[model samples]
Target: MPTDAHPAAPRPAVDHDVLIVGGGHNGLTAAAYLARTGKRVLLLERDDHLGGAAVSAEAFEGVDARLSRYSYLVSLLPQRIVDDLGLDVRLVRRRFSSYTPDPRDPSRGLLVDGEADAASARDAFARVGAEGDAEAWQAFYAETARVAERLFPTLTEPLPTRAEARSLIADEHAWDAFVERPLGETIDARFADDLVRGVVATDGLIGTFTDLDDPSLDANRCFLYHVIGGGTGDWDVPVGGMGAVSGELARVAREAGAVLRTDAEVVAIDGDSGEVRWREGGVDRTARAHVVLAGVAPVVLDRLVAAAAGTASGATEPSAGAAASVAPRDEPAAGAHSDEVPLDAGARHRLARAGMPEGAQVKVNLLLTRLPRLADASVAPEQAFAGTFHINELETQLDAAYRRAAAGDLPDPLPCEIYCHTLSDRTILGTGLAESEAQTLTVFGLHVPDRLVDAHGNDELRERLRDAVLASLDSVLAEPIADVIAMDAAGRPCIEVKTTRDLEHALNMPGGNIFHGTLSWPWLEPGAEAATPADRWGVATAHPRVLMCGSGAVRGGAVSGIGGHNAAMAVLEEELP
Candidate 1:
């Protein structure tokens, strides 16, 4: 084991073998791997702390709940990385995967139990007219598992050709349904129940704002990442919140001799020269490295480089919900939507062609005094909220919401998922709060697309959206969700809302996209057949030495360290001459 540096120790060497921009989890993962290889790695973050969006914090003032504010839950993080890094983290699997209450029948609801509870699992499916779907569900997931087994391990390895990958799966029908065809078509064909179909379809719309049957098959890309995580697609709750995950990664990196620094914002990167400029302690600083792995999104990297080279007006991009003439980078070929992004037409053209990924999801964290009474009296509140409690997420409901959102309007009844993390782990709440039956609830609203928010006046829009979400919740619950409140010191309800605007302003996430950008096919598609081995890793940039170690990489997005892992692999390997 390498010696670890004290947190208060002076900065290490200015020059390093690798300089990772952005002290996010992915950056920390890269630093850890590179350090293990005996490379001199240095990580820089703009914020005062590590763990970019993956950190847990006391969101509401005067509240003891340490919430996973930005990105919650873990599905993509590989256990292999945990073992390899010797990370001290525990992931608890909920016994109940989800419980969707039937609006037509308040007394009964669909409850998806863990695999061990086969009886309950069957009962839930049967109640929803998905008795056949239980078997179909198993068959469908078995194929995903096969795909996962074949594909997940390759994420850390060099990128394989499309043909090579297909040969490994060796299932033509599976490929056609999952890869070639629209996810909506596959979901409708596989499951007879509209409710069941919507449950599966939600995976495709996690962060993507697109039509289910869009020609680009963007939803398929999103769905694949959601399910293929760790080859099992099981989303587990991280013990001690998400901060534990990133904190452990930072520790592993530091223990392995990686120098980590926060509040050291990287202002510019010259990929050709392997030079990085940053601001620290009220002074500009420069560092040299053989490789510069950017943990930031591609659009951010472009702006940083452009600003340093005097091509753009400055480093800062326009805030989210704003109308910008210059397109966000790595956006789909849709169009430009953000306000005045001071970039050249060539740069804007590039971003426009990629098409912008606008976020539609709204995250709300609440500290409830006690669990609300469920409409389905048969199921205990503890079991119903333990995992995901589906509200207004039926197939027809989801379709209606999606259509409205796609038309730049907020859905009437927002399709959202609610889960109480405290039911599984009571450690998130303060001792005083935890003892008194206080719990933390995380609600994620779908179909509240970025277009719905008024960029110039989002406060009103956000308030309206929040009200709509609460109203939607009230429709399913026996009592109004707002009635059971834990007041703050100021006597206000202990609840915090995060809109797409909040994401954009707080985390610099353009259009509030949680995945950083639109999800793309992890492997080489038809047009990308010409990509090189490095390009296949999705880490390669126009500049040879500047690799993307963040969610922008191929097989990227989610909380998984695949992007970081692939970036490190790219650096360690030799390119084909």
Candidate 2:
């Protein structure tokens, strides 16, 4: 599992069956799927580790270990890939306990629905309603749950074809005439109260830039219909953490038959059909494969392939496919431009990052001398399950916090998410390293932006960001959780952004935007932009031998190894069996 210390030089063809670039979740998943299916796959990652965003770094001496310092939360993953990849080995999918405090009446709006007691919870939820709203909400869930149940079989059944859709639409009406409706609109129609509706609607709009008011949000909600509670609840982390999920995928892929190389930064990708070119171990090597599968972003492929073919221009508009899906326009959208982003992001990109320190992000891991004591008794006394608690301010407040960070000064009130890993496994971080207490607080922070990296690698801004986080935590409760700190801060600033950025940088993708091409509601489902479609990035078009398997390919974003699995199936179905 040792990773390369140096970068691979400019290279030629390094032979491989399916040469995969990048070792993040998508790349790893694709590698595992291919390897498991008996395809000769070689995975290269720039980072020393394999998890990508699902990484678990040991920062601060004697710090309790956990998944990616930045990325957390899951259960939105497709179940088909979970069982297929045998992720149960490391996938500890557990939903954390969620609480939203109403400073006025702490108990009223604190608990997330599923964690609430059904009878009393229903009564409490009804409080958000006018008179008879509680039963209405429950009835709505029951109805949606049934549709969600019926939608299960389609998740693993390959991308939807037009014919397939016609045959499959057998009374299962998850998406009806109101497909493009926003979840907010649906919430408005379903309930009246602001607090009640906000808590429930949070589930529908977790990922995606689309505000709750965005029309495509409804389809986002439909995605939840396919998830089954692994006995926990609707939302849960996969067992250990995000690392476990990707680690499990790595195990499955390695066990199947894939060879992985880490820190193998692919300087260039050469050749087209029936062969793959890559550099590894700081030596140029040629890998020959019937198909080349990529698990990074499409932009990575665009760059590698474009560089291989030699292009005058080295970039495309970000989200070109999504923009393309809407309509064809002559001129590009403002700021939808690109070029080689030397080292850190360019000025425009920095503007996009807003007011963060150069290459610095605000990440704080609190290893509590004890568990966090929520002021609310509901979460405090029982502290039943280990789950993620979101410290979400109103949208306006949250936006203002980011605006402040954009201004290069720490926000007065930082937003954070506290995850409890010890609640489920009491001996969580204390397993090997014997310790008296455990740190249940794991925070995902964005108070520090990537615009913070200075020439001399200064960390003055990082310290301030950390202080603001602790201050925020202290503000929540009278007693300082830092008082019980056994571990130090966890996350640090680096070029690695989200998994989307990971895919792009690793694979030379154009924008690093996941979801292959388009991100519309129609694209994610079985019907239009499924895996088997022809308009995909490199999977379907690049080469007869190359299979696209990265986050941009198919079965994307999350830890599901669908991109690799589907690519392997593409090659295997055609060439192997």
lDDT of all predictions: 0.79, 0.50
Which stretches in model 1 have alpha-carbon errors above 4 Å?
1-14, 116-120, 313-356, 526-533, 574-577
lDDT tens per residue, model 1, 269-320: 8756778999999999999888889888777777666555655532333211
lDDT of 2: 0.50
Q: Estimate each model's TM-score.
A: 0.88, 0.73
Q: What range of 10 consecutive residues in model 2 has the weakest lDDT sum?
A: 320-329
Best candidate according to lDDT: 1
Question: Tens digits of per-residue lDDT for model 2 on 1-577?
Answer: 3338766654344455677777777777677766776777778776777877666555455455553454555644666667777677434544324555543344434454454656766665544233356666666666555544544344344555434543444433334422445665666677765545544554543323234565555335433432322212255544565667778778887888888887676644543544445656677765555456666555445455545554413332222222221101122223445565433444434333321112223445555556556555545523422554545443444446557756755556765556665555443354643255555456644334333333112355545556666766665554665666664434332111232233334434333332434332212444334344323322463444445665555334444455555555566556542
Worst 10 residues of 1 by lDDT: 318-327
Instruction: Identify the runs in model 2 with alpha carbons over 4 angstroms from their true place.
Output: 1-14, 76-79, 82-97, 113-117, 126-133, 161-178, 204-207, 216-233, 274-276, 312-364, 381-385, 394-415, 426-428, 431-435, 445-468, 487-545
